[model samples]
Target: MAAIELRNIVKVFSDKRRGRDLLTLDNINLDIEANDFVCLLGPSGCGKSTLLNIIAGFEQATSGRTLVGGKQVERPGSDRGVVFQQPTLMPWLTAIDNIAFHLKLKGVGKAERHHRAMEFIDLVGLRGFEHHHPSEMSGGMNQRVGIARALLMNPSVILMDEPFAALDAQTKLEMQEELVAIWQKRRCTIVFVTHSVDEALVLGNKIVVMTKRPGRIREAVNFDLPRPRDITSPEFNDAKRHILALIREESTRLAQAS
Candidate 1:
């Protein structure tokens, strides 16, 4: 059974200044399988993030339906965890506390919170810095905290909106590797939104490419390239070329229409 199902999902934003309704997404339908690493990839303004938000229940669809775990999503819940581009952590709290904050909010005991958070801290390779505050950590470290926090929820689905977009190239690469490792080990469904073609290729087993504004799925490419993917391999380059062509064609089509 599919972990997430989007049936004819559409999103429209009111453009008060323009006195019109701008269609952001148009009839998006997709089924993400359980334990799938699916990347919603497209150019900027393609509404990939909006689609992810709808799935996460942060935003409602203007029309159609979104289902997670065979149930309709009406509001955000613990079944889904979201990681934004920024590490939205509590600056005053220590790493372990930040990670266990959600449990604390639910009235979990302090001993249990630390015990559970410690597992994720170790999972994200932050075992030594559990007491460090956000101010004392680097961007990569804080992002790790964000990821660990989300993971601690043990959600059925994880939604990430360009979580590594702000990191340095080296740090981004490291985080990507760590994330893939975590996903492999945990076997949870993940829907990640990214504008970078290479980032999608590196992180997703299934790449759902979206079109320009009034977004539609251009194609859903299934890439089973082996882990520790060689970026320069012939198979990798071949796949990249195909995806680039699809995006280029979309751009050209839009240009001609304009």
Candidate 2:
């Protein structure tokens, strides 16, 4: 069974200023299998984040249905972990505390929470920095803390919204590799949203291309490229070429409409 399912998802926003409605998503039907690293790829404002949010139960679609783990998704739950574009960590909380925040919310005690979160702190490579606050850490480091916090929940599905978009190239690449490694060992479903073709190609086993708003699926290309992928490999370039053409067409069409 699919870990997460969206059947004919539709989202419409009221635009009173224009005296009209804005259709943001149209008939979005997607089935993400368990342990798949699926990237929602598209240009900016294509409702990629909106789709992720719907699945996360942070935002509601105007119509249609979303199911997570064979149950209807009516609201957010600890089962679905979300890491937004920014690391929205509490400034005053220490790294370990931040990672354990959810557990704390569940009424888990201090010692137990710290013990459970320590493993993730080390997992995200923030061992010594556990005592530090969000302001005391670097951008990448804070993002790691954010990720660790999500993982500490042991979520069956993790939703990411361009989590690395703000990082420097080197740091972003490092995070990508680390994330891949984490997914490999943990075996959890991940839906990552990004606009960069290369980023999606490098990270996702399946790439779900989306169109301009009222975002619809353009293509769902599956990649067989081996892990620790060589970006310059012939097979990699061939796949890139196909994805780029689709993206180029999308950009042109959106530009004309706007």
Candidate 3:
């Protein structure tokens, strides 16, 4: 069974000033298998973020339905963990506390919460910084904490919305490698949203590209490049060429329309 499904989903936002409803997502259908790493890739304003939010249950679709683990997603829950673009950690909470906050809501005890969260902290290589607050951490480090917090929930699926977009190149690469390692070990399904072609290529086995606003699936491409993937490899270049061409065409079309 698919771990996540979106059937004919649509989203429209009211433009109160313009006095009209602006369509953001067209009727969309997607099925994500359990343990799959899927990336939603497209140019900015393509509604990829909106799609992620719907699956995360942060926003409701205008029509159709979204399902996670065979249940309709009406609201956010611990079953689907989300890591946003910016590290949304609680500034007032220490690293360990932030990671354990979900457990706290579930009525887990202090000693147990800290003990459980410590494993994920160590998993994300945040070993010595458990007691540090968000303000004390670098952007990448804070993102690591955010990831750790999501992982501590042991959710079946993790939704990441451009979670590394704010990091420097060096830090981004490090985090990507770390994330791949974590995914390999954890076997969790991930739905990652990003506009970066290379980021989607590096982290996802399947890539779904969508159209500009009022987004519709342009293509769902599958590539089996071996890992750890070599960006310089001939196979990698071939795949990149194909995907880039599709995106460039979309860009040109949009530019002409405007």
What lDDT does the true structure give each of the candidates? 0.95, 0.93, 0.92
Encode model 1's per-residue lDDT on 212-251: one tens digit a residue.
9999999999999999899999988899999999999999
> Best TM-score goes to which candidate?
1
lDDT of 2 by residue, 31-105 (tens): 999999999999788899999999999899999999999998999998899998899999989999999997888
> Which runs in model 3 stand beyond 4 Å of their true positions?
255-258
Clashing pairs in 3: none
**Candidate 3, position 120, lDDT:** 96
By descending TM-score, how would the candidates be arranged?
1, 2, 3
lDDT of 3 by residue, 134-241 (tens): 999999999999999999889999999999998999999999999998998999999999988899899899999898888999898897787799999998888889
Worst 10 residues of 2 by lDDT: 249-258
Model 1 misplaced stretches (Cα beyond 4 Å): none
| TM-score for predicted model 2 compared with the true structure | 0.97
Per-model TM-score, in order, reads 0.99, 0.97, 0.96
* Candidate 1 Cα lDDT to native: 0.95
In the order shown, the candidates' Cα RMSDs to the true structure are 0.7, 1.3, 1.2
